[model samples]
Target: MCSNGWIRAHATYYGVNDSPASLGGACGYDNPYHAGFGAHTAALSGALFRNGESCGGCYQVRCDYWADPKWCLRGAAVTVTATNFCPSNNNGGWCNLPRHHFDMSMPAFFRIARRGNEGIVPVFYRRVGCKRRGGVRFTMRGQGNFNMVILSNVGGSGAVKAGAVRGSRGKTWRQMTRNWGANWQSSGDLRGQRLSFRVTLLDRKTMTFLNVVPSSWWFGQTFSGRGQFL
Candidate 1:
């Protein structure tokens, strides 16, 4: 668990019939299923969601009890990645209910609960290091000389605190501005050369990925590197 310790929250799932299951949520991820993304994704409430900046953050959740004690998982827990927003004012929404809440994926919710009790379950959860299969992923956006990059597939202190970029032909590294959520923007044009990026995790540790973006990279394309904060 993260330094925040175990927090009480309500846990629910979005089954195949839900929008998040059929179509991706607000985070822009297309495939979030367990077979696709390993059933490790979740939608967090506004209290802990941090807008979209919480994307990639990980949490460890345990089903302590449901309507009946038999439905509990006996403390077995599952780690889920933050990938969408759970709004607060949508009638049944609990995103802003003065406490942290997690609307987990169906597979993730079941991982910590007994069968047939998949509805609302009482949970104890906390922030934790994200264990991911690959290194970090960088998605390119924007056009011309400007660059807007979205960082994902992050592990460990899952959220990025800062980032920098350098062009293959440029002599110095340039810092990127946080546009919103996991997206960052570089001030100058990097269209003519391959780009290298330096990322800093929320834990204050930093890493440099050299030449991760090819010179011929196009807008809306994504590239993966071989390093992570974990």
Candidate 2:
């Protein structure tokens, strides 16, 4: 962290300006808009991605106008959701380890920098609370004894640290392991049962979404909870 809470970093942009091409990413938010992230999203470097644990996290980023006045838009900042990863490149890319960087969507980058900044700019960023429109959502996938759920629309700390699932027929909650990105998996056969979820956020607050998934739920269906992290 920088002295004043902001951390020094570099930023670049990818995909078309505000287009759907920027939607899906490594975080499994195939359609960020549908996942409640909108187009204001970014791909974090390995230093920040934390092996996908940083997915759904929010950050406030602004170009360092004082450091690069010619390319930065003074006082302009944008809050973006972490939805992708900026992999390390053998050619010593900006996203390489030890170098904090943000691969932002085109629209997000342009918000804080001049259009012709050559795709990169000095930046300062800080984690911020995610202001989602609703309670946390769970998108269900997989079949039979294998269950995969993707958590989204998270608020507060935003990123989920851990999760557990309990079916109506089960007396105890079973821990769900991280499958990939924001997807959590469980080998329990939870078919034809109402599902409750207990999610722990990075802040250590656990919110239990009781019976968030109905017994009639099907694959590829998303269920919304009634509670959200503060």
Against the unseen true structure, what C-alpha lDDT does each candidate score? 0.77, 0.90
Candidate 2 per-residue lDDT over residues 1-230, each given as its tens digit: 67779999999888675443376678887688899988789888999998999999999999999999999999999999999888897224998998999988887889999987687899999999999998899999898889999999999989999999999998899999998899999887999999999999999989899999999999899999999888
Who wins the TM-score comparison? 2
Where does model 2 exceed 4 Å of error?
Answer: 17-21, 90-92
Worst 10 residues of 2 by lDDT: 15-24
Per-model TM-score, in order, reads 0.87, 0.95
Candidate 1: which pairs clash? 34-39, 145-189
- Alpha-carbon deviation at 12 in model 2, angstroms: 0.3
